[model samples]
Target: MDMASVQLLPDDVLADILRRLGPHDLAVSRCVCKPWCAVIDARRMLPADAHLLPLSLAGFFTVSWTESLTAYFSRPCASIVVGKLDYLDTDDARSLSVADQCNGLVLLHRPTLWPDDQRVLNPVTRQWAKLPPYPHLVSPCMKQDSYQREDMYLVFDPSVSPHYEVFLFHSVPYNCYEVDVVDEDAFDPAVKKMEWPPSSYTLRVYSSKTRQWETKPFIREGEAAGTIGDMESALSPGHCHAAYWQRALYVHQHDFVIRMTLSNEKYKVIKLPLGLDVRTDDEPEHYLGKSEKGVYCALLYGNNRLGVRIWFLDEICGKMDWLLKRDINLGNLLANYPWKHGDRSWTTQYVNDEIGRSMTPAGAKFESDYSTNDNVIVPEYTVSLLGFHPYREIIFFRTSFGRAMAYQFNSSEIVDTGYLQGKGPHDCVGGSFAYTPCRMGKLSNNM
Candidate 1:
């Protein structure tokens, strides 16, 4: 056939090809033709399924006053903006007690003077509605002292069906942490109120569909008072794995691991490896992540402030194996600091040209220099191994400034996501947030 007579492929075919390319390549492909450019732009429209894709990378950039949650097409280098959720101008009276993200939905609890009084859930679209106060079973004996009781824990199970369940675990006057549940159905629009359950000594489970709080018979083997510290202790529950293979929820309790099936209400406790030496403390906090291989991993900062250790769990033998992946000894990096008090906080900056490096890893290094006007302090940080489009080897971490600094795996250079916008350093936040992939499917189109 003559070259001039050859039939051209449709725009959808070209668009699909472009979508498969890396972010950098996709940008170049968009310039191929007007039809291709239109298709590329349309594909940028995020679908809900994009948020549900397992193994996809997501970022949660939070500031003290505002939190910006963004999910990229893959990782940072791809530059494919999938979807974003913003929480701006929050009230100081109510603090963000808990942020549990699951299946593209985030449940944020804002505790009021009355325990479990005000809470909300924000899905991928940022649509939020007030949740009713959890039904509390106040003990008749402690009813008079309820105002003085302060110790509480907010537990959220995102995988729960019907409606997402939020459980309030608090000390009822003379007692320790007891469970109280809340969901959309519990809200009474007419009276704008929910009935609180009666205080009990045992753990209680509430069913949204049944609209009742049933007492859980299983007594967890632990010191209830010591397990949950002082009233004001920010004892946020650590990561709870809803294992796809086992179809159960695995929660780390102090020294033991608790497994509870989705169908059953009681938890089965199993002891972890004793020699692992995993510190369950405030500093060098421990976080959990699962690999595509179904291996459960834990990330913890080293005891000596040298680096982080990544622990892998062997499900076959129920053993824990760990590797010291990165050494972050900042002694050499901090020697240049002129401060004599050691009160000054130190942060690091990546070499700007290492944006696309394949082996460098994604995170900020420790730097003592703050003399330059461009240098700013980063309070908190988080790193993730993300799979961005075009190049699947990019990892990035966001600062409290609402900006994400990404690096290529091979190179140590840094690429700023806010470079094109010219935003300043005061954009980030001070706390850590969760990132989970949302699948791209028919549900996203309707949104």
Candidate 2:
């Protein structure tokens, strides 16, 4: 009874007909043969398509804080995930960097070390996990802290839990002390009854299902946006971007948004769309994501149209806010592309000298000897968003003229998806994370 050839069924009836297929039809029924791809890879049957599809952006990691480098942008037929993390066995996996990525996990850290070995990568199943040194850096009040800033964040959800969490997020210096101080009014009423974003806070979380490191506590229901000394003012500058959604996490600190929720540990602050002035913004950038309609907040708007606006967090009825949705003006779409070094000002100085001579840092050394005519004056190109599209309405960006774009928003269309090159000229794109690939099978450095 070949109902159109099941090849005489039975591998438990072809896994009950491939469990009613969906994960893009069970990855196109594993190429329809070779015995249904060895019975779908020997019964590991790839099924949790996170509530049925919509997790395919497969590429982009970026990080490059002055060239420690993470870089991995896709498309050139995406030859199966290889961001060259060099198997992260670390003794200096080039001093690591990417401190956060979720769903398909990735936390990596070793930012110039100090108990910062932190691992946890998955780059499409080159599975990894390491993390363990951060129970408050062996507290003695963080070894008598005089200054500290911590940030980690990576909270996975193979559709609700295949177990993964990291979060950290700490800061110190509301009134740091001890320079052999003989009490300067004993720090004046503990810095006037302390309370800048503190109604309660604890957070240290780690848990890959009890592989340890705990601390939770968060309780600040509302009213308190600034003044934890504005988290050491000079307004944020970097390291603050988070998004987990549903199990809650949000966080895009400074000029509002803290959220937290992680199953009732409770936290709230949300406010960043009422004349949106992240301290007179001239772009320090902003982001917090979850897409295909849910939570979003882009905002990088260096006037004169090097645009980006986005926003959408509308909870409605229980009343949450933010509404404007999409403004996009990428300097009039790179002044109409198609340039070839003839116009848009030496094609943006030959795409910033071919992205600083073909992206450096991997062993460095890839120099360039400048050459451009038309009186070279073309220096002004910057747009960096690189996220969103967890389900589409696209939006990933880069460009100080090196290009790594995406932008879809219901097809206002712009694709290019490649080159983010850079190694100097203050090497940019310091953080970007959209990658999405997760079958979540292995990933256990056994705690």
Candidate 3:
């Protein structure tokens, strides 16, 4: 057979060739011919089980006016959107907000308002269900003539099954902080005891399949000084984690940095690393963001830099390690550039620095606009610390600001990946983007 003959090539052979191409080349190849594009779309031109499909690593970031939910590929410069969540819709609502993402599923919560009010579990896919109300206290024991007792309490156990359960912490008249989980299958809110204080109560798990909360009772406590307080102070809506690793549902506590494993209606709490503080002095706020592959915690810090940190729980050590990092440094990059309108004062020292560097005035103008920290001109997208090449290790972000930027780290220098300026309309607040992996066979002709 002639080696150059296309008809002699086997389907697997062509796919192997396509699998090696980059995303851009693959995209262009789709336009070469319909049959070729179809073959590529069918993914038949690539290996059936190759792992280099340009997987994404994503997280959430915030700016002045709106919150940014972003995603990027594992290669430094390749990031595209899979979703965008708006913060305005969730403010002050009883909903848990986006807590965390694991294997494409998110854990949501809804707190109680009244005695009969129930909590909720909502998946990002929009599937939702209600949990039973937390257990409340009944009449305390004493002589029949004793003054009317007035103590009530409630507790919460997310590990509960058929319905995630919570218990009232105190008996009435006194507020309690302790909650315990007794059964993993059926979470009962009716049990009561006068001697059990709020601080000593632990949550119990109830399993849906087993139809009971738990067979064995267990109590998990945090290292923090006080008992779990109001849900807001104790938990950041989007910072918590509920994931499945090793065939078990693992709930990660943001406040205590603890991981609890739920298996066979039993609960076990595992402590994570010591120095991981989700809140930093700079941004002082948190948001949840997701990508095609995993979830990440977003924080804002000094110099108006947006930092994203991805967490992976280590089952053996019972801790989470931070990986897949990206940072946007807008302050320093925009400093000393001339304002677009030329109305703002420009420092002589800064002007001299720009002149001495031979940077053209137009370049300086664009830089100034791009880097400006105006409260009103929120960033639509940020340059990833990675780079722009989809095949290279890259991370990129898109914002309501109508821009897409890329970044990469090369030894000591953090450089721009690629940038698309003015791609957004004036009033758009939320938008999403996705990346399609490139296969090598498609690039053979272009390369």
Candidate 4:
């Protein structure tokens, strides 16, 4: 049909036609014109697992090391929502990286900028808020290696409130310089060292409501994970991950999950269960995200079989508990997408690149434990969890063989979306953030 004819169609007829299309197409159809956008928004045509009108999964923004690029992978129809971010005051777009994502907004950071500049962006609406500079915390114990290892997390939930918050948590060195007065003229500079996981945590938080930065202190609720001397590996880059759910922020640190209740200003350290601990040599791939039920921890185990175990957080009793909700063997799913001929997984990186070599998964550990089926030639594939669907019961992940798949928890259905971006997938997706297209109003300064 011609453009004029399509525009002439009644609103009811247009809504019916648009409803037949998938979520991707509906998002693209909204960009066609004001009439179509209005009809879709008014009729609530998009697929929303919770609230209507403004929330739906668009795609993901991934930061891959191999490509040295922060790329957006989404359906061709909904690609427009993933803007170029031209509004930022930057000549080159490559200077910015997606630090974190929350709901429909993404926190962009420019490490090259002095004092570290960050901006919160809404890709769908192209509205952004420039955050004030982060407050500085000077540690009395200054070591050369203590370059102030820090992490930033974005929290935004439209279902609850419109204002967004950014949390900054950093590590402090062990020893501090203290003065001891033996007499009025004689004084001694005594060195005092504090242990890791301090009794209280003072964090820097930025709120859009006030358009300013404030420090919030959280008291520790339990035993410490370990001492500062033992956290060399844990505090390294790319070893930490954070998630926001149920009005609180859960950060993965060392062998425990740091639960920070924003409303109560209390933090608790919940040690991982025996097998789920990250301190082991054979660390299973796990990710923290929210699904349909609530906060979920997805772990991929290669011990006996290539299986996935999902744990649900049960907080009804006012205690931190991880209840195993689903455990499924992925042997059948892997069988369908066999490795290509003459294709092999890269077991190790080059010797010169020590960091990449350490990050690479140990190939021998993933050996199939299928002794019962001796005749079956099982294939070994390295799988990584990308992110979870913010509203639905799905987990998005990628395989070494260049495949992007989503597993539905309720139905145990695995959908092979396609190749990761294109064919011949690169195993460089270091991190991924789920992007939900939200067309809310402008992010105003006042709440």
**Using lDDT as the measure, which candidate wins?**
4
Q: Per-residue lDDT tens digits of candidate 2, residues 388-440?
A: 87766677876654555677887788765544656544367667777666656
Please give the TM-score that candidate 1 achieves against the real structure: 0.47
Give all candidates' CA lDDT scores: 0.35, 0.61, 0.31, 0.62
When sorted by lDDT, best at the front, the candidate numbers are 4, 2, 1, 3
Worst 10 residues of 4 by lDDT: 178-187
TM-score result, candidate 3: 0.36
Query: Candidate 3, overall lDDT?
Result: 0.31
lDDT of 1 at 90: 41
What are the per-residue Cα lDDT tens digits for candidate 1 across 131-246? 54455554333333234232222233222332333333333221122223212222224322211221123344444344445555443433232322222232223222222223
1-447 per-residue lDDT for model 3 (tens digits): 223464578977876777777554555565466566556666732445222222223322111113221222122332322222222134433223332232222323332223332322221222333344334333233223322112111112221211232212221221112123111112122322222223233443433233334323334443332322221123322223233333344343433332233343334443332234434333333322233223333344333345443233333464344453544455443233222323221111110111212111223334435554531233433322221222233344433223333434333233332222221233222222222331211101112
Estimate, for each residue in 15-73, the C-alpha lDDT of model 4 and write its tens digit.
67766765455655655666666566666733441222344677777766554346565
Worst 10 residues of 3 by lDDT: 345-354
Backbone Cα, N, C clashes tallied per candidate: 45, 1, 81, 0
Who is ahead in lDDT, 2 or 4? 4
- What TM-score would you give candidate 2 relative to the actual structure? 0.29
Q: What is the C-alpha RMSD of each candidate to the true structure, in Å?
A: 13.8, 21.2, 16.0, 11.2
